[model samples]
Target: MLFFSIYNQKGVPLLYYSLQHYLSLAGSLIFIPLVIVPAMGGTDGDTATVISTMLLISGITTILHSYFGTRLPLVQGSSFVYLAPVLVIMNSREYRNLAENKFKDIMKELQGAIIVGAIFQSVLGCSGLMSLLLRLINPIVVAPTIATVGLAFLSYGFPQASSCVEISIPQILLLLIFTLYLRGVSFSGHRIFQVYAVPLSVAVVWAYAFFLTDGGAYDYKGCNPDIPSSNILSDACREHAFTMKHCRTDASSAWRTAAWVRVPYPLQWGIPTFHLKTSIIMIIVSMIASVDSVGTYHSASLLVISRPPTPGIVSRGIAMEGFCSILAGLWGTGSGSTTLTENVHTIDITKVASRRAVELGALLLILFSFFGKVGALLASIPQALAVSVLCFIWALIVALGLSTLQYGQTSTFRNITIVGLSLFFSLSIPAYFQQYQPDSSFILPSYLVPYAAASNGPVHTGSKEVDFAINGLLSMNMVVAFSVAFILDNTVPGTRQERGVYVWSNVLDLVNDPTLVADFSLPRKVALFFGWAKCIGA
Candidate 1:
């Protein structure tokens, strides 16, 4: 199904493939900033800045990963893996009632935590500790761990989208139609509609909603359009006020406020504030991100070159991700960069595994980041539409995560129980912790309620930092799932075949095979210079 193989450098085809990749990046990649920045009490302009910075960091990190890491065509960006912990950090007791400088304070905290976690990840990978851990990371551990990430957001998805059912419903329906029903309909030998499903669905439904807005569908006679929904004094307008914010095409002022051109630079938010509590939270999250990226790398390598990269290569990829995340931290993205799970699906759909094309697509992302309006325009997308897209996206993550079970014996009772228990406890244990010391006095948004336990959870270790770390980690679905699956899978007895062990290439075999060397080895000069460090994937 490959339209272009891994080494293909043909210009026009590469350009087309790159554009496809870029379009794919537009939806999920931009959604992170739109969700996170606002939740931190940031302005529309701040949201736009974060979006642009995410793009820039994504582009830079992906390019680094392709050439110097596993050498696969995986894209890197801000990920949902980091979303829960960031929310916990932002909603902690110390930050709950900040009257001023709220956004910058939270962002700087995130940056410091991300930097510490990134450094830890770098050491983990560069020291080759990751490869040793791979033996315990079979499909049994990965399937539920990754699935828990998607399931973690179940409360947030529909509740947010339902605010503007008119827009959100149509978006969901249109996207489903394009990706499912109309997928067979091709254009000029390409499945253009299916390949561009997210963007196309957004466009069609966005225009439809624009017409509804312009036609005064949500207009309230006495409501002040400039004020927030809570400020509406008229009872009649108060009910409709909420609708105006999400349904209106111009609800966000990002477009009006963002400059025409701007470039993102490191430390733009301010100097980060390092804290033991936040750093511990992110360090755990970084491990989950590494595991998530490992799944992506294994699958993408198969699509690109029909074999998984060697353990050393996987280690290199993780190291590169950590280094890239350091850059993301300095840039204050509020999230770390990692290999996107969507890359496997993108490669399967487009059949464009060419490294050159991926690099070109990354270059395009970098170029687009310089245009401040691009970020503003993306930020201006209606909240309902963004959530609608996320609903489908989170479902896709679940599907993809479970699909990894194909590598193992999915019919086995042991595998099934481990996965089921992990998932059930992942959600259930968090609920118990979250409800242990519930605060009835503070009113928070529906989406942020799950993370509210960060301020008043049951875990009291005397030391504030220890209590925070325990509470925060336990509250995260992915962390709990990963811990359970990893421990059970390692402790329980099962054959390699039954466990569905990942078949990573041996370092000796990798060094011996010329083809694999070509596919995954470091650049010639770098390899020669760092030959002494080969034990650690140098």
Candidate 2:
């Protein structure tokens, strides 16, 4: 039955080509732990167990979707972008201080929103709304947004890479040397040898840290003390500590610090609830997520497809993405989205675009997710080893961005301006937020009174309401500025001198063959002009 199901759908031979494709697809799995674990941090038994189980189920769903839905070879995993926001939310005192039952209630609410957003995505896909939206939003706008994301993330990468304490000057030199050695070996027809260098280097570093170094100082565990029992109950705890007794004997701690400290023998599951404030925040998150997903899909498609994807394919992919997120919410995991540039690079190198192969890879991921020991084992892998791997992954991510830029028509002044501005905003805003508001208690757009109240507790009080109102007014002003820019750019006629020879040629082309220029709508034309204006203005 399984064989027939696999063979009949694509009308391809099952054994011959399928196996090779599967292997190629499976190769991409090498990136999962390397990329995900560092950002996620080491999970103790409880969270680890829950996350692992969720991973397996999600992996299975992803595999099934790849096989039955799109048949595009794409590996699905926990998205990295959501990590920053989620960490902030989870760490918030407001989330933590809620009475034991109430905290769980809030979790349900947040999860519910995620599920709803995801389902909306799937609905958009089925109804072809996503495709319509894509067409309406000028690619020029998207190009700048996408370029901004890369530039923004580049700023993030520097801080993140620097945070890897194990990554010393010596370590970087070692990584460079090994990378070059692998390149040389590949040229000399020693492909197998080349393949081993990265993994081998990581293993060596880990072994050195474990045995030669003074008790693995490079690892997070080595530096931080065990979770305090009293601290667990302090309304600031976001993670539950796992001890030998908790995992092996299933003993409850005497202190009982956290409300959810005791592990239920049979896992408890619940539906998500909703809150108005959280919903508003989620809506913002969804918009950002949508932009990011679209950009990633376009970039990947440019690399893989000979022509632009059909609207149907794009919609289906978006719908599947939404479906995946809904499932993730249900399973008590963070949000999921399309794999970003790093994994895309992995796919390109592996040359495995077979959906079935990706499905098998998902199966592997699901298996890894279910077994608590597997996650624990991975966590056990020394920090030095993880850093060694990340050193390579981070470099690869930067390279992917640079490579994508090569596909642009020209690295012109307008392109540079867009890239510069986008990078600046993404990096600067986030940095300012982090530096000024380390407490995580404050609401965004810090000028409002209701926001001040919202920052204080779960329910909004008088002052908080006032803060919220003020913040809303300020936000409106910003929106108006953007609206003005949009309107003026579209309605204002260009001066005759401003319309150069190149502009005249384009105009002639549009007039000569209206059908050929049908897709170039007014908004898009205006956006192109604005890009030039920004370049000159800058």
Candidate 3:
């Protein structure tokens, strides 16, 4: 059924398919900066710069993963798995009150934390610890842990989109229709509408929002159009001030202020400041990220190769992802890189699993990164419209997480109870910590208030560092859900079949079927170079 198989290298199909992948990934590629930069007190220029850097790192890492890692056709990018932890660090007590060089200082702290965590993750994988850890992970554990990642931000997604319903609602509706209803519609023998759903919806809604702004939809009679929202004195105008800011397509100056071209480099923000508390937080988050990637690796291999990869191959993929995250930390992309969960969905929909297409798409991402205006243009997307897309994305993540349970005994009482409890407590426990915030004066937007649990939560262990680390980890829904599920699934388990322990193809299988060796073994020259490492599943 595949239009292009894993090794297919037709030049024209490669080019067309690669472009399709890039367009599908564009919104999410630039999403992190739009969410985190403003919270860190960064400017539009900083947002655009981070977006560009992320694109560059994603491209490089995807290519690296294709060559040396699992060699799957999966793309690597900034993952939301790192987002909750980063937000926790950003909203910590000391940084909360900083008045000078806030953006640079925060970026440096995050960089240090990410580097330390990435190093730990690299050791965990390269040293073969992940293979041991895999024995404890099952679909029951993975299901709720991954789902909580998406559910953690329920407060933020739609509420932010509601800020400009006129634009955001239509955007959400259009995207749904394109991806669901009109998905069957095709052009020139290609499902162009379905393949380009995200960008097409954004373009249409963006133009409509532009017309609204140009036609004075939010103009106030007593307000000066040029004045900042904070400076507007009229009470009547103040009511509509937030609307104008979010609805107006010109609200951000990223495009006007950005340069024609710029290359991102290491330590562009400054030398990182290593702190024990933040580093500890990121280390734990990195483990969660690895757990997230494990499921993706299994599912993607099944979809592409009809067999699971050996544990050692999964380990190498995790290690390579950690190395890529190290690069992201050095360049300060503000989030770690991982095999995107969306990659599985993309392959399923596109029916193309060619490594050449992914590599070519990555090169296109790299080329786009060099254009400062490309990142700026993405940075300039209206906040509400962006939030609308995120709502759908987060929902999709939830669905995908649940879908993994299909590989297991989904109808079993044990699996259902474990998943339900993990998800319930993940939400319930975080709510308790977030509600315990003692400082009422610290006012953040409603959605961000959940992430502010690090500052004034009830965990008081005397040592500020200990308290910060504990409180921050507890506040993250993924960490809590993972701990619960890992414990329960390991201890109160039933049969291996009941637990749905993933059974990877073995060395004997590869030897019996020479074709699998071609599918998974290292390139011939590289395999010869690392013959001694065969015990590690290289």
Candidate 4:
């Protein structure tokens, strides 16, 4: 009996472990083409290669965290939201036309800022400040804000779906029909079909689109096989080093020239530098990242844990995100944050809560990060495949947001009003800003616009007004909206309830518990020490 008990405790069914590993890997891969490629664009083979290298690094780190750290079934990658802001800062007309030396200085400064912000996040996790912030921000407020993210992304999906050159009306319809058929069928056999239906759907779309184009002449050999250019690789490496001075003079010519310099394995770009601007940006990034993490944690806790996450667990997870961001900065990637929606999706699909699995995945990501060649190969995936994946993921995000509304109590006029207006302003204000922005030529020389214009060139080009519209709709500056929502949800005359939700109580409980104290890992203790030091200093 004793031996049996020990064996049962130590053993995991092989099939279960295998499925979990594959799911985690698939989740990581899906984000590469879906989120990363779309934001980065397709033309710059060098940029694509570098970004892929970064993703590979991030992937390996994720795998390591999964294997050796938390071991949760989660994967990490470049965040889509950060793309717009970083691009705005890096290639914006405000900065791009500056002298090479100035550009390098600014880039270094920004890197510094990011590092500082990451440190701040580490502190927040360690000191349990995140929990306090959560307490102050009511769920009513959080729900609508999160919902807006979904609503904002939802607008992009249809356009993206339609924009795929290969995905025609009939093909999409057929794919949808196939998806429905798969969904309708139930079996006791291997659940792989259900588990990977979305990816399968994407494959069908890609296959159909491939056949439709070039009369089946769209073979792999026919695709562009040249590697990215050395100059492009060098520039990307320099940028990662925070040395922007060496970027190509002619942006257009450079892109065209460096279209074939793809290195197959991960190459080390020099370490990142830190600066004030980067610090500020990192702060913002960390805050947004924390918000995203909170949302994901809450969602996952509700779905799987069936209770609010203990403070120690939450802190550890958040600290991991901060650590990942630091690693990201060191490795010359954008930023790293906990992706709640993605996490929730993984949890829902896999139904595995073992931290060990996530750690394994993180270990895998760490290994991949070193392989530039492998990164480049992954980057070579077709763009159409990416668009399809995002369409499905974004749709899931929307569904999750709607699910939160089910938790609300009173369907009061004030509640309805807050939700409505928050959604509207969050979507509208940014759109307006992007639409009326002066031409890049007006701000900088026409030659510099492609490389300089922060929003990727002119907003009002021809009949494609959707660019401006979508930009304005998806803007994230919803502070005012958040304020208004908070007032309506918590401070309105009749809105206050008998007992308010204390989001931080969970953290406080963990911190106060003597038994829980024993579970604190070495990293968590260090995080706490730094957090305390920062608080005292402040």
Global fold similarity of model 3 (TM-score)? 0.92
Tens digit of lDDT per residue, candidate 1, span 204-223? 99899889988988777777
Clashing pairs in 3: none
Give lDDT tens digits, candidate 3, residues 1-538. 2335645456786798777777887656877788889889888889999999999999999999998788988899999899889888888767666577888999999999999999998887776677667767878888888898889889888998899999989999998999899999988767877778888998999999999989988777776544365437778878777877888888888999999899889999999989998999999999989988988898788888787876657778888888999999999999998888777777877788878888998998899889999889988888799889888888888888888887788888988888888999999999999996636545566678888888778899898888888888899899999998888888885887888877742233333455545565545324322322223445
- 1-538 per-residue lDDT for model 2 (tens digits): 0111343444344333333332322212333333333233322343344445445644665675574433455555554444333433433335434354543454465576677667666676555555445533332234434433333334333333343344333355556776575545554333432334455555555455445334533223322233444335544332423321112111222112222222222114476765455455444455445545555565455556533343434555666777777766776554444443443443444343455545655666665654555545443443333444544554554454434444343345544444445444444444433343324434332312111222333223456434332232222211222223223323444332221112111323333445443565665444322222111211
Deviation from native of the Cα of residue 537 in model 1, angstroms: 6.8
Q: After superposition, how far is residue 197 of candidate 1 from its true place, in Å?
A: 1.4
- Measured against the true structure, the TM-scores of the candidates, in listed sequence, are 0.93, 0.62, 0.92, 0.68
**Local distance difference test, each candidate:** 0.84, 0.43, 0.83, 0.48
- lDDT winner among the candidates? 1
Give the Cα error of residue 110 in candidate 2, in Å.
4.5
lDDT of 4 by residue, 147-227 (tens): 554444443445544544445344445445544566445455434445656555556665654454436332233222132
Worst lDDT run of 10 residues, candidate 3, spans 525-534
Score candidate 1 by lDDT: 0.84
Which runs of model 4 end up more than 4 angstroms from their true locations?
A: 1-73, 94-114, 153-161, 168-181, 184-190, 209-267, 270-278, 302-304, 367-373, 441-490, 493-538
- Candidate 4 lDDT at 72 equals 42
TM-score, cand. 4 vs. native: 0.68
Please give the RMSD to the true structure for each candidate, in Å: 3.2, 10.9, 3.4, 9.9
